[model samples]
Target: MRLIAGATAALSAALTAVLLVPQPASAATQLIGNGAFTSSTTPWAAIGQTTVTAESGWMKVAVKQVVANPWDAMVAAPTTAALNPGKSYTLSFDAYSTTAFKARATVQYTATPSANQLLATDVQLTTESKRYSIPFTAATATDTAAEVTFQLGGSGGAPTVRFDNVSLLETQTTRPTALYVSPLSNPARWAGDPANDGDTAKAIAADIANEPIFEWFGGWFGDITKAVDDYVGAAQAQDKLPMLVAYNIPNRDACGGQSGGGAGDATGYHNWITEFAKAIGTRHAIVVLEPDAVAAAECVTKFGKDPEDQYRMLLDATQVLRAQAPNAWVYLDAANATWHAPDKMAPLLVKSGIANTRGFSVNVSNYFTTVDSETYSVAVNGYLSGTVGTKKYVIDTSRNGNGPYEDDTPGDNWCNPPGRKLGTPPIRQLSGAEYLFWVKVPGDSDGQCGISDEPAGTFDPDLAMALING
Candidate 1:
C-alpha cells in the first residue's frame, strides 16, 4: 500500500510539472505593456503637458481643447510584437467621455517614422465607458514600436474623453472549441406567444448542424420542445449535440409591448426549466437559458412590478437546471450589444449565481456591426474578467451583416433593418467568447416593429439568401 501511494504521488507531481512547464516549440509569448502608461505622467511630454490622470489602475489623458485642432497624445509599445502574416491579434482598451465627447482614436504600428501603417482607426465615441478592440494581422512592417494615438478634436463643441488599460495580445491558441445554434423560431414564438407557427424549428436545427460545433434550441416551449426532441433524436442518430434556448420569460413581451410568453410566475418558470432539463435527459446539448430575460429586466419591471423576485427566480432556475443537466453546457442570454453594459450586468448575473452558469450570449436582437459586436464583447468581457472574474461568453451573429442601420429614429429600426450584410465568418474562438452562433435565424422577421414587411415567425428566403450572399 505504501509503494502504491508513493507511485501515485510521484505521478501526480510529474504531471503537475509537465503542465506548468512552457512548451519549447510554442514558447509562451510575452505580453509586454508598451505604453502601459502605468508610470507615465504627462507621457505626451513632447506634445504638451497634457494632464493625465490615473485612477483605479487606469490611466486617463483628457484633452481640454485642441487649440490648433489636430492635437494628439501618443503612447507607444516598447517593441512591435511579431505576428505571423494572417494570424489575428486583439488590441483592447477602456475608453469613455469625461463628458459627452466626439473624438476618434487610432491604433497603429510602424516600421519607419515615415512609413507608419494604421491597423485600426477612427473608432467612434460612446457616452458609456466602453471597452473596444479590433483584430489585426501583422504587415511587413519591421518597426519595433507600436503606437496608440487619440485625435481628440471634434466639431469644436465635442466632449472630453479618457482612455485606459491599453493592451495588445495574440489571440488565444485554444479558440472556441464549439458552436451553439438556438433551436427556437423567434423570441415571441419561443415564449409560447400566439405569433409562433413552429414549423421551421427543425429546419433551423438542420441548418445549424452544417457548422462544426454544437447546435441547440429551446425545449421548454410545447411546440418547440417537440421539434427539438425530433431534432435531437436525429442529431443523436448522426452523433451530434443539439443546442437549446430556454424561453419561458415571466411577463414576456412586456405585457403586449413586443415579444412575450412562457411562464407567468417564479414557481412556474423554475418548474418549467427543471422539467425541460429533465425531458432532454442526457442528450448532448448546449442550452441557452432565457433569451432577452436579463436585457429586458427593466421592461419587465416597468410592465409588471419589482423584478427582484424574478431575478431571484432566474437564479434558482439556473441552479436547478445546472444540477439536473450536469452533462450540459448552459448559457444565459445577453440581449444585445446596446442593452446592458457588462459591468452593470455581471454583478446581477453573478448575484444570480452566474458563476455556476456556463457564460452569457450577446447581440441577440440588434443589428450592430461585427466590429461593434466585438467592441461590445470586449467591454462585456472586460467587466466579466475584471469585476466578476469570469471569462466565458457566446456571440450572436444572426443579422449584423451591414452593421446597424445609420438611423436613431427611436422605434425598432435595429430589428431586421435593411441593407445589412453578413459580418465576419462565425468562428469558434474569439477574444472573450466561447463560441459564435446564429441565435436568431435570419429568415424570421424581427416582427413588424421595424421596417421589415414579413409577419413574425415567417421565413423570407430572399432575406436569408441576401444574408448568405452578403
Candidate 2:
C-alpha cells in the first residue's frame, strides 16, 4: 500500500510542475509565433494563387488574380498551440493593400477539411494602413494545428496586400472602477421640481434621479470653465468620478441637423477644448470628446470643407486634453455600430488621433442593443489594436433598453422613436466595454420628434416619465 501511494504522489507532482510551474502566469499571452515577421516568414505560407514573402517588416502577399471565392487566394500561418474550447481570443493585425477592397480572415483547421472555422469575418482594406481586432470564442473542438488566414481573392481584381504585427492573444476580461452618480443630473432636478407632487415625482426620484449620467458642455454655455469646474467639484466632494462631454468641435454635427453648431474654426475650437480640459485640471473625470465629430466628418465635403481639417482639429483636441487633464480619461466618440463598419471607421478613428485618447465611445444619442454595440466596438478595436495598441471602449446605454424603434419611416428611426425604454443604468467594469454610460441624458428631446415638441437638449418630464415606465 505504501509503495502504491508513493508512486501516485510522484506522478501528481510531476503533472503539477509540467502544468503550472514552467508557464508564467499572465492575464493574456500571445498565441501566434513569428507574428511580427521581423526576420522571415518561416511558419507562414501562401495558399491558392497568392505568393507570400517577408519584406522589410511585413508579410507581403501578392495575389496573381481575383479568384471566384475569397479563400481561393490566401496567406496562412499556424498558431503556437490549439485554442482552448470556449475561451475567448482576439486576433489583431495591421494591414493595407495597393487598392481598396474587401478581404476575409479566418481561424480554421490547418489540415484537410479546414472548413472547421472558429471565426470568419470580412476585413476592409484600404490604401492607408490600419489595425484590426476580431474577438471570438473557440467553439469547435480544439485542433492541434490551426491556422490564421487572410483571404485576398474575390475583390474583382488582384491587389497586393501587406500585413504586419499579426497577433492572436487570449482575451482577458477586466472591470472598471465605480462611476459617479451626479446629484445635479436633470432627473434629480426634476424630482425636486415645484410642480411635481407625489407618486410621479417619487418614481422619477427612485428610478432615474440616482443614476449616473453625463453633463454636456458647448458654445451654448457662456462660461465653459465655470460650468465644468462646478460640476467636477460637486463630484469630487463626494469622492466620485465625474462624467462630462466636450461637444464644441469646429463644424460640429456637419450634417447641419438640429444640433449643428460649433466653434467658428480651428483656432476657436482649440481655445474652447483647451479651457474645457483645463477646467477638469488634475481631477479624475471621464470625458466623451466631441460626440459626432469624427463620424460625421464625411458630410463636411458637401459644404466644401476638407475632412482632413476635422481630423486635424480632433487630433489637437486629444493632445490638449492629454497635456492639460492628465488624470481624466477621454473617450473619442465612434458614433455607433449602425453608422459605420469597423473598416470604414477604424481609419477615420486613427486619422482623428484615437491613439491620443484612452479609447472610444459608441452609440451616443442613439438606441442600439448593448450586444450589437459591443460587437462593433470590439471589431473597431481589432482595427485599432495593431495601430495604436489595444484600446478600451465604452457604450452609451442611456435609452436602448428596448433596442431600436422600427417604424414605417426608417429615416426617423433615431429621432426620439416612441416606445423606447431606458437601458442599463450607468455602471463600470462590464464585459465588452470599459463602462456603460448614460452619455446622452434620457428624457432630452431629439428635436421635436416622436411625442415631444421641444428642441434638442430640452428636458421634458413627460418624456422622462415615459422612459421610466418603459
Candidate 3:
C-alpha cells in the first residue's frame, strides 16, 4: 500500500516526530549523605560524651579526651537489607583525624551466617579528612538479614576524629561503550606514528572489535589539530567513538633531554588547547585530558618551569573542551593512585572551573589494587561532593588484580613489574562515578621500548584472558 502526502504535510510530520524523540540523558548526579538516613529512625548515639554536629550533608563526630583512647559511635542501618545474589554495592563514608594518632576504622556488614562473608575490615585513617568505599558482593542466600556497622578507633592519647557523609548504592553492571589508548599516535615513535605498519589502533579494532582511544600529538606548544581530524574521520567511518589523550605539557617529558619533547611556554600550551577544542567541536568523543598531568606536575615544576601555571592551563583546557564539545564526555586523568588527593584536587578543579567537566579518571598507568583504587575514588568523590556539590568519578582497571608487589630491586622496575593480574569485573556505577573502564589495553606494551628499558606496558596473556573472562 502506498500513501502520498504533500511536501508541506510531510515536513510538518517530520517536525512533530523530532519533537517527540527523547534527548540523550544528561550526566547530572545527586549527593547522598548521613542526614538522609531512612532505614532507621533512631539517631546515631555519641560515644563517651562526644559532640556531634550536622553540616554540609555530613554528621561531624568530634571528641575530646587527654589520656585514654577516644572513639566516636554511629548507628548502622537498623533493618537488614539483603543484597541480590552475585550483585555488588559500594559503601562509602568520610573520616578525619585532628591530631597524630594511630587510627583504624572497622565497617561490619551483617550477612547470612555462611562460609563466605562479604565484609570490609581494618581500614586505616589519616590526619587529613578523607572518604573510603568498601565494595561487597553477595553470594547465594535464602533469607534477607544484613546490616552494616562503621566503627572508628584511635590509639595512645585521645585524638579527635570526625565521621560523616555515609551512603550505600547498588552499582551498575553495564560495560563501557568506549575505550582510550594512549601514546598510540604520537609523532615521534614507531608505534605512535600513523605511518607505522603495526599501529595499535587497527590492531585493537580488528582483534577486540573495540575502537582505540586515539591520542594524537600536538605541535611543540599547541593542539594537534590535523591528527585529531584524521583519527575522528577514520573512527566515524568505522562507526566507532574516538578517544583522545592530551599530552602537550609545557617542557613535555620533563625536557630533561629525554626522548620526550618540550613545549615552549604556557601561553603556547593554552592556545594549543583552544585549537584542540575547536578542532574537536560538536563531536561525540571520549577524551582523557593530559595523562599524568596532575600527578606528574612536580617534574614540570622542577624542570619545565611553572608547574602550577601548567596545571592551571590544563584546567582551563578542560573548561574549553566542555564548552566546545557539549555532547562529548570530558574526563580528567587521575593518572594513578599516587596523584594528589581527590578532595584537594577537586577544589582546584572547581576553582579552575569544572562546571562543564564530566568527571575524573583514576589508575591510568600505575598498578594500584582495584579495592584500593575504589577506596581512593570514593574519598575523592566525597570531597568533591562536599566542596563542589557533585558526585562523579571514573576508574581504570586495566591491570590491577595482584597490584605491584613491593620490591627493593629498585630502578623503575614497577613500570612493567611482573606477577600483576586483572581485578574484579568492571562496574558501571561506583561511588557516584559513571563507569569503571579498562582504559589501558592489557596486551599493549607500556613502552618498555626494549628489554633494556625495564618493560613498560609489557604484554601478559594470562592477565588479558582473565580480563576477557571477567
Q: Could you tell me the TM-score of candidate 3?
A: 0.50
Residue 231, model 2: lDDT of 74
Cα lDDT for residue 400, model 1? Answer: 68
**Runs in model 2 lying further than 4 Å from the true structure:** 1-176
As a TM-score, model 1 comes out at 0.53
Residue runs of model 3 more than 4 Å from their true location after superposition: 1-223, 253-259, 409-413, 422-432, 441-470
lDDT of each: 0.53, 0.78, 0.51
User: Which rank order by lDDT, best down to worst?
Assistant: 2, 1, 3
Worst 10 residues of 3 by lDDT: 1-10
User: On residues 51-100, what C-alpha lDDT tens digit does candidate 2 reach at each position?
Assistant: 98899999999999869899899988888887777766657678899999
Show pairs that collide, candidate 2: 131-383, 132-382, 132-383, 133-382, 133-383, 175-429, 176-429
Tens digit of per-residue lDDT, candidate 1, span 255-312: 2344555576777777767666654544456777776666556666676566676577
Candidate 3, overall lDDT? Answer: 0.51
Root-mean-square deviation of candidate 1 = 25.2
Tens-digit per-residue lDDT, 68-92, candidate 3: 4323432344323455667654455
Instruction: Find the candidate with the highest TM-score and give its number.
Output: 2
